[model samples]
Target: MTKSDTITWIRLSAVRLPLPVPVSDAKVLTGRQRPMTEVALLFADIATAEGHRGIGLTYSKRAGGPGQFAHARELAPALLGEDPSDIGRIWTKLVWAGASVGRSGLATQAVAAYDIALWDLKARRAGLPLAKLLGAHRDSVRCYNTSGGFLHAPVGELVENASAAVARGIGGVKIKVGHPDPREDLRRLTAVRERLGDGVPLMVDANQQWDRPTARRMGRALEEFGLVWIEEPLDAYDAAGHAELAAALDTPVATGEMLASVAEHRELMRLGAADVLQPDAPRIGGITPFLQLAALADLDHLQLAPHFAMEIHLHLAAAYPAEPWVEHFDWLEPLFEERLSIEDGRMLVPGRPGLGITLSEQAHAWTTEVFEAGVAP
Candidate 1:
């Protein structure tokens, strides 16, 4: 049999990539202190019998490292001797295999790594970039900066960060809201708007800190600033609350970053929970289900602005029929050798095959543990 016809082996590693500058956000769901020092990245590499290799990765913010890694180990043996190109079948198989303890969270994240690796292999075989392989809708997509606008930073520092991004030609900027005092949130947003001027698009993420009443009140109060959208103003599962908030406010409501599956996104859309969808590729079971979520959002007339990991989202956003926005967060740059190009407020889609990323030597040095899984006899 040809080497490319069957899967040979899978390699997984858990790397502790430290943040250059610790980040803090207002909505502390984990009951932890501000400024998390690092994040755990679970990396997967799949090798074909034909000598082709593809890479995939998923991450956890604080805990769950062992769970995600174990899930990868558990699912790796299922792909032995299977056709790598049969992504749909492989994905379904993995989902059901782990159905007892899967379908969301760590299990789906493990599935994402495998699904993404399959797509990378498929794209490489086709000699086409993933975006083109998926059918390109545009050559580039608009982007906004989110890395610089954290909740713990001083207002002046936030202004400076936004200014730097704007000067670099980023079309928009977003800041964290949901401070304990509503007036503090207002003060920060007002300062940023004044610094950025009226024409530049601005956004705020509450990180699901407020109740429906608070979201309504704050959304109405901030309407005068002319935001691009208000993100995660209520809990992710509070579909009814989100819909009511969207109805009451002029600012478009956006969420779904924390959702683990397309079914959750469907519920959000069916309830009119948001006008914009912010699906994350890894969080939604890789590009396979991400495309599913994107199509659903498009059919429902919702705008697309995928949540972080710009390397993957850039391609996905470029393929969206509507001009979708990609969030910019550079904390993960240390893990990759190559970076995306931004020109005149838009991110250019890479022409490289697959996801167009390579793990850096730094990442290798930072890895804490590694695991290998082989095909079943």
Candidate 2:
């Protein structure tokens, strides 16, 4: 491939991948939603005239798969002959191509698939891992587990899950909080804490279920547990409340995973609302906006613990200036042929070029729809 090489084709696939089991969280306990049994993944594959290829993915939990697929299909034609190496430029072009619906949320989410593909393509073109391409700060990151600690699990299950995670080399454990009965929430926390012991890192997430007074009260109670962080105790958009809570609490406040734009995250930084910023690359328009946000967060001296998509976040987290954390979820494991190595409580960076992942046969078997657009050589 040369500078003259251009994108030849782009393929998009929408797969309705079923979860092995339904998982519930604070949202379910609050009756705002039901257990989630499946996820919708939008995968973008970009190929160039020189036979170079790259893959990227974005996903929706309950809804927006069709919307994202429709939006992605609508924008694929615009990249038929553009240089995939021109990632930032292409990101701007795609954002404007779908400007009517706005740049955040679903529109940018759709663009995220393509944006990430370009980044992956560029890294592969260099024969380097994305982290190395971006100048990595660390070769491994501290890892934690959330899949085993949902609110639906029984106390014994929670302990077992935490034990299993610890035995598997996960450095920290986070469980769902914000139960209908605050006592029950505390009980769960205490049980998990007692089981994990004091030295281990422990965290809890309210999943945006607590109001101001409740958040404050619970934040006060949570102080005794020596939590590494308390996450999303208020609504995702309540920057002011979070700032106030951060000022009042001893535990670090972490949020921003649910936020969908750089502008929204800037508000968090402006107010110093959070101690740890948990940005999801796919959720906020892929690596393009994620990097933009990371740069801003770096300037503020914020801790990075990006939420979900470990395969993608691992590389991005590695590139972060501060020592960052990456989440570990086994749900997406079936979609990729390779597995990440967890050793000594850290997830090691793979030496494979690009994102270092290849889709599994099962991933294709679950695909509900696929489409192609662009000029293939």
Candidate 3:
């Protein structure tokens, strides 16, 4: 067979690309103005070696590099001669080797992009969508509106945006809260809850902005609203604080986006830091590790609610029983190949191979010549 037809090896590299235009209005905390720097991942296609490719763009609000792109670059050399289809094995090898180096944090984040890209390529080559490859039993996964559109707006505006989401047939909604004043935060929560009504699932995330005592107080105050859960109420690393809050309040505690390693998940579970574990596919090493973490969460009887990147998270959640809600944020759709659709409050998990999502024509053009970042062609 010709080398092109035979399954061979994969090469890895990344593009230091900028968004079409600067997103100056983006947020982190306190409504500060910032621009986003994306570290786009491109895996060489040799086996399913078509023009097929995938992009895993890292969203660093501070326009950060090196640190963001480090994992893809560091792990690429080790992956040069490996089979693109051997994703599970590749994931295991990396985990075992990086065991002492640590699995959560930056190392896993980087590995996640590479593994996701490889999976994308594999799906495209096999002429199958990601959902089908993963043995999808359903065509779509339900999603919650996270607008993530704006966080520092006035109370009325927040309600309007949320109402818009509700009108769109979205069954769930998530809002950001971490204001220093307890009363003011409560008002915001109360306003949102009032707008969404009693039965709707309303969840709030503190972004790890509150301390232990303050978090407990806020959790208690918000309990009357009957929040689905209170998220990242304390520092992501403070297992003790999480445990304290979890034990003190009636509201279910949820956290894990800040955690990058499986060991941390183990500790958090042991401490009862949270009743819900939120794992981001790219944040905690990639699909393989995320799956492992989901398994752990399953064993712990905790619910799984992934942080963001709803497109990819849908598949991961679909594969596991624990994931109940997938955060819906469309900020990165312009950079992707295809947009994952949400119908009747559910997202259609890509039925094609790999992640089931494709690179959109605009995404390809943007990442390729125009974005000044070459994608695998």
Q: Residue 58's C-alpha lDDT in candidate 1?
A: 84
Model 3 root mean square deviation, Cα atoms: 4.4
Choose 2 or 3, whichever is better by lDDT: 2
Q: TM-score-based ranking, best first? A: 2, 1, 3
Number of clashing pairs, model 1? 3
Q: Each candidate's TM vs. the true structure?
A: 0.96, 0.98, 0.82
1 versus 3: better TM-score goes to: 1
Cα distance off (Å), candidate 2, residue 241: 0.3
* lDDT by residue for model 2 (114-166), tens: 99998898899899999999999999999999999998899999999999999
Full-model lDDT for every candidate: 0.88, 0.94, 0.67
- RMSD for each of the candidates: 2.1, 1.2, 4.4
- Give the 10-residue window scoring lowest on summed lDDT in candidate 1: 26-35
Error of 3 at 54 (Å): 5.9
Which candidate leads the pack in lDDT? 2
Candidate no. 3 TM-score: 0.82
* Candidate order by decreasing lDDT: 2, 1, 3
